[model samples]
Target: MNYYSHNIGDYAQATTHLSLVEDAIYSRLLRRYYAEEEPIADNMTQICRWVGARTEEEKEATAQILTEYFQLHEGYWRNKRADAEIAAYHVKAETAKANGKRGGRPRKEAPFSEASYGGTAGNAGSSENPPETGSQANQEPGNKNQELKETSPSPPTRASGFDASTIDLPDWLDRDEWCSWIADRRARRKPVTQEAARRQLQQLAAYLAEGHQPGAVIANSIAGGYQGLYPPRVQARPGPSASRAQRLADWTDDLRDVLASDRHPREKFMGTIDATH
Candidate 1:
């Protein structure tokens, strides 16, 4: 899989005791695991190299994190959480494939009723605009309007005819964001089918259960241009004083800027701010 969900709160809480380097190593290992959709290989040297752990400290951190977080199963190191995610991904993929083979979502046929038969009979005349008759003729204007609405043909069985507005949204879901997401899909020429929407909501509910905000989860998919919903990516939290990792990253960017501008690199060491104060 090219992508996987990363819960920032969960990761931050779990890695609170880890040093910056160890945290970095852990992140790289997770990326590899998700991309490969399999357990990390049991070879320590190869795993260290794959995650770019060159120094002794980095290598040791790599080994320590792997031992503490992953369980050695048979010949590979496995993470229970990662395994469960991969399994769920496969199940959803297979379901979508099967749905496609059946020519999109199954049509929801409106149940036939005597009222529907009456409506059909009302329209049976050859006239282009059939005259209202029977009960329709004797009803008040408001009642006539109601009868007309009830008699309208149900939406066609085609996928395009699925009305998203009629969807029964959950109370926890934000209505505006949901409508925006639907609009985004339609603008991309990828209309959401009823079944697809139902499945996405089900998945969204699971993410919500994990303490993810509904808006953030939906926004993640919209930003990524993803047709299916996914948990939001992890974001670094800000602090009054930058962490060592943040400082190093800022320093790297400043170095590049200094080089490009032909200024003394020492003029700004940690960030764009002048260092000579």
Candidate 2:
């Protein structure tokens, strides 16, 4: 495949072969990430805010900008490394195998057998781990992970960014406000008074920011009026004390112990603790 085919964003950015809407998005993304120091998605939302097309016409314009922005350029495609050593190693191995010649013996791996590792033989009856070797002793969690964890990555709670469904942004506003509200909503559990209302709009604007204008959107959102929705708190009233506080709390003791482990599947999983809390 050609370099352009490697990335849809690249192809879209390469030429004006797409619709007006597509061109607009492609233009924004390029400027945001390459020209300006904004993220791709951020740029899209900002464009959404600026276009502010509430009707179908506006949304279409916004979509066009998105398509174009997603189009990565050839330089980025070239910059992206693909672990050439890995491919080279595989090619060499394949060539060696095809030649029907003895290429080389496999390197010996570190022995992990319990018999060869432990200090004594009779203690094998016990169920415990053995002493760490120098190689293992030097290793940290990252070195021996079953899955590679991203280094310097944001926590799962927030990274790249997080989904702000908890805030429940309104549909009336543009993209800049939407993203802003979500980000701030997670940071603060509740909004109070006019500051709340102010935050709501600014947040909406921030949410409207495009992928390329993420930082810009975030700034607008911080400055705008936005109010987060929170459920009203209901105060619990005291009921007639049928029994004393201590007596009522002690009801669990009075309830007869019943073993119904045989009646349900959960009981099978519970095993010994099935009868207790």
Candidate 3:
């Protein structure tokens, strides 16, 4: 008789579960004794008792064949079950549609053409007023919006639809200064410097001397620390240097005065500033 002739379940009962480990051991036994010819089919109870005595390590070695066999067989049933589910869905959809047609409940109407404002549809332009039922885009934002449409103008031209690119951007958005301003704000950060560190210490001392509250001390210390640590790498040219003179006369006291008055002297900048100062 063929070895392993009994069903896999009988062989599996040899172990608690047909665990891969049990199958491995059984296969090994098959190969060793029945290599040349089929081995006699062992009883399930006897096989279970025999497998129970064997180490799990021995069983795992023969598990591959059993694992592959079950995987292939199991996958077939899984696919069948999935196919059954799809068929059920199709039947249910058909039944629902039939019931809807029979008017079991109020069904949602398919959009064809709706009357203007909040009223029902009729022939085109049958009513002088805009459609009250459905708006141009068929958008129903809210009850207030529906009511408003009922009271307002007829379907608007397609041009009235929202397209940001078609919109007129605010004057500030088109200006280079606006972009530069944002860039400056983003550029504001801590300064990496020794002098700034010293100033930070000095500010802390001043705050303590002034007997300021802990919060104020922390706030001022942070600000002073940044100012001391980060020195502006680009120094302002004294009185606009020479090149500036070519474009707008010499850097006279008048120009220097203007620059200083307007904060070109070094007041205008980004970062943590002493607003109180």
Candidate 4:
């Protein structure tokens, strides 16, 4: 598994209480888990060395994070979410390999419609059509009339360079919203090209993998008047009716833990709350 989906909302909610050191340790552990595609060894020393957790605080954070997020199996530590993602990756890989064996997807054929082409041949090449046989057709090959007609060129076309119609949007994306985004870009004098369109779709797909609604993510970019799509930021503004403690809790997950635990001294509690503000 070279890559795995990381849902920002889910991850933030789960680890919002972690310190910077804890966060770094956990990230490194998950990376090793995915790279090896196996459970972590049930050895703290090895785990600490693997993640380069040299200091006492770093080592303690590594242990704490492992205990909180992982389960101790027979002789290893296993994470349910990581295991599920690995299993899914394998299933997808096998499916793709099987599809390759079958020569990949077959292209869709256009539906037959005789009305589109029925009059084309008669209108273009038939001698029986009076419009074709009149004036120009009856003129001699080297005559002045033929020369004049041949010299008259068709009107030139003005190319817009970019074609919005060629973009093949995914089914999950709202067509109207996507069109509005394209229009917004054009109005801002920064029209989307084929390469830009592809990159945007890829970014949108990444957001989708992280459990973001396609409509909302696109709408956020449009609302912000941004040139590129971005993951929505978590707003921390509390309501006017909310208490100071509630607001602090929303701002810092560690503050919530401090406020909830009576084991900490009053001075420490006050210090934590004041530090966040």
Tens digit of per-residue lDDT, candidate 4, span 1-277: 7898898988999999999889888999999999999999899999999999999988888989999999998999988777656655654565457558868755554543433322455454443434435667566434744655666565556445766545555555678887888888888877887557756766666666556666787777777667777656676666667686775676575443344332343332222335565
lDDT tens per residue, model 1, 156-175? 75445776645666656778
Candidate 1: pairs in clash? none
- Residue ranges of candidate 1 with Cα displaced over 4 Å: 106-277
Which one wins on TM-score? 1
Tell me the lDDT of model 1 at 203. Answer: 77
Q: Candidate 3 lDDT, tens digit per residue, 1-277? A: 1222234564455455555665555555444333333222333334434445355555443343334332234222112222222333333455456557757654454443354333465455565655556474355446656675566655544332222222222221232422332233235643223222223333333333233332443433234332221211223444433454443333343355445334344343222446797
Better model by lDDT, 3 or 4? 4
Clashes of each: 0, 63, 22, 0
After superposition, which runs of candidate 2 have C-alpha atoms over 4 Å from their true positions?
A: 1-16, 41-45, 50-55, 64-277
Total colliding residue pairs, candidate 4: 0
Off by over 4 Å in 3: 1-187, 218-277
User: What range of 10 consecutive residues in model 4 has the weakest lDDT sum?
Assistant: 262-271
Report the Cα lDDT for candidate 4: 0.71
lDDT, model 2, position 61: 63
Q: Higher-lDDT candidate among 1 and 4?
A: 1
